[model samples]
Target: MKKTTINYLHVGYWLLVLVQTLLVSLGTGVLGTTFDWRLFSQIVLPVKFLQVLSSAIFFYINYLFLIPVFLKKGNVIKYLPSLIATLLIFTPLYYFLEQRLYPMIGWKSYDADLNFWFAVMITLSSNFINIFLAILLSYLMDWRTMRIQKEIIEKEQFKTELAFLKSQVNPHYLFNTINDIYALTQQQSAEAPNALLKLSELLRYMLRESDDQFVPLSKEIIYLENVIELQKIGQKGLSFVNFEVVGEVNKLKIAPLILINFVENAFKHGTFNKKNNPINILIIIHEQLLHFQISNQINHVKKDKTGGIGLVNVKRRLSLIYPEKHELTIHQLENEFIVDLKIALYD
Candidate 1:
């Protein structure tokens, strides 16, 4: 809480207590309540002044010192005795202040006609009310502060983990692409110039757009298309991957680079039999819902190991970003591997 807010709570609570004390003192419950100015100023004011000041002192002592030192540490034994000790110390001090300060200030002192133990009991009971309020407010404020801190830490973790995943996965793909461009240059192939240009565009997209939390669906689609084109060039102009987009991509947005891992995974693991498309990716959009599917023929020669961030990283990303907003299913059939994913988009 802000310091001003906390101050307001304290001031308001004490004011309420003072009002209640005045009401009881002036016989509020007894039908004809009369406000005697002299009685209020002389007797009630002096007594209430001492009561309120002492209560406020003990409240801060318990709130700022005792509670954290004892109760928060689960030391109830020490905490309860500490409360009793402070109440004992402050109750006697109230009498001493009344005897000395009231005469000096020319205000009449209050003396309730009761035995010593009975007066001590009454004082302890009233003091406990202040203690109870202090403890309640302290726990409430501390709990809220801890919860806010947890949420901030979680958000930071999300960003850091996402960035880490993005960084770890790309070196493998970029290395292969660089090698392909280098071979094309050695042969002086005409496609070499175009490949280098496309790589430049891809690099620009990664550095500029991929850092964002979200990107337009059109930009993501274009990025994917450019990736497929570069991969085709890397394969010596063979069409081993097929990508299909259904429905309008306008006005839609998605997490940047979210879909790239599945495509890269397909290229890493799938066999090209020269019979059918080695990798097939299909994406469908309707309203704010998206359905994505990718499948590739099993390349038994490939194993479940890669230097790139793999399916685990992608799964973690989807959970963190989409949470209950997405569904994913993976199937490993005898001859093919398939991934089906659905996401509910947000504005």
Candidate 2:
């Protein structure tokens, strides 16, 4: 049985016992002429005891027989009928013990109506009331419990997804930067030292801020600049990339790595072409609304499809972190792919 149902049944047990005690006392007063308060107390006490015993026995019968059949094979027909049958079975047994069995054990009987009619009336009334109450309470408790469990599950899933996003951002960045460094190592470039320095700064940022849900917008801008510098070391010429930031950052915190994947995607795909191809990034913050726009000039003649994993990861991260709080638009033209994102910042 559901928790609320059991609770209601428990409350009903107490109410029933109190009512029976009151009725038995009144009946004792009417049936006898002496009207001794002690006699009334004695009559009420055994009724209370018998009520408690009957409640315990009824609980056992419901637990052992009624619940299994009701839960598994029950329809509307079986539900009410089986409960009524169980009540009928137990009531006669109880009346027998109350009238004959207790009297044999030197316990005086209270009222001597241990017949079929009274047993049937009590059984039908009590079980009918219990059935109605139990079903309603059980349904409500089940609904409440289900809602609470679903909310807990969703929170846990969101946390797990956030952790996964952070992991994706850090490793994806490291792998790309390391690949660029490997190329510099092979070609013996003059900007290799600057690349290593920027790499170290990027690693520091990751270690410090990746574990947090939000980081200062200024910190994120610095980290983006570091990544851009590292990417520039591997570029063949300055014309390959262009980045600009126009924003006042005093007290704003945003989800980190929100803009890096676009830049990374741009460089990974746009760098191989030595033509006038360019990757443009512009970020502006105004009144707690940050607008980020990135456009990468793609060479459709020689476009590479191998650089989309980081972009996809970042998209997933943005969705998880900013459900209804951010807007992302992506457009793929013949020669360029553009991404525009507007995010709300919080302190």
| Model 1: colliding residue pairs | none
Model 2's alpha-carbon lDDT is 0.73
lDDT of candidate 2 over 11-100, digit per residue (tens): 786778667766765776643666656644665456556755676566556655565567445565776687777777877776776677
Give the per-residue lDDT digits (tens) of candidate 1, residues 15-89: 888877777766643223666677677766767767787778888999999998999999999999998888777
Clashing pairs in 2: none
- On a 0 to 1 TM-score scale, where does candidate 1 land against the true structure? 0.77
| True-structure RMSD, every candidate | 4.2, 6.5
Model 2 TM: 0.63
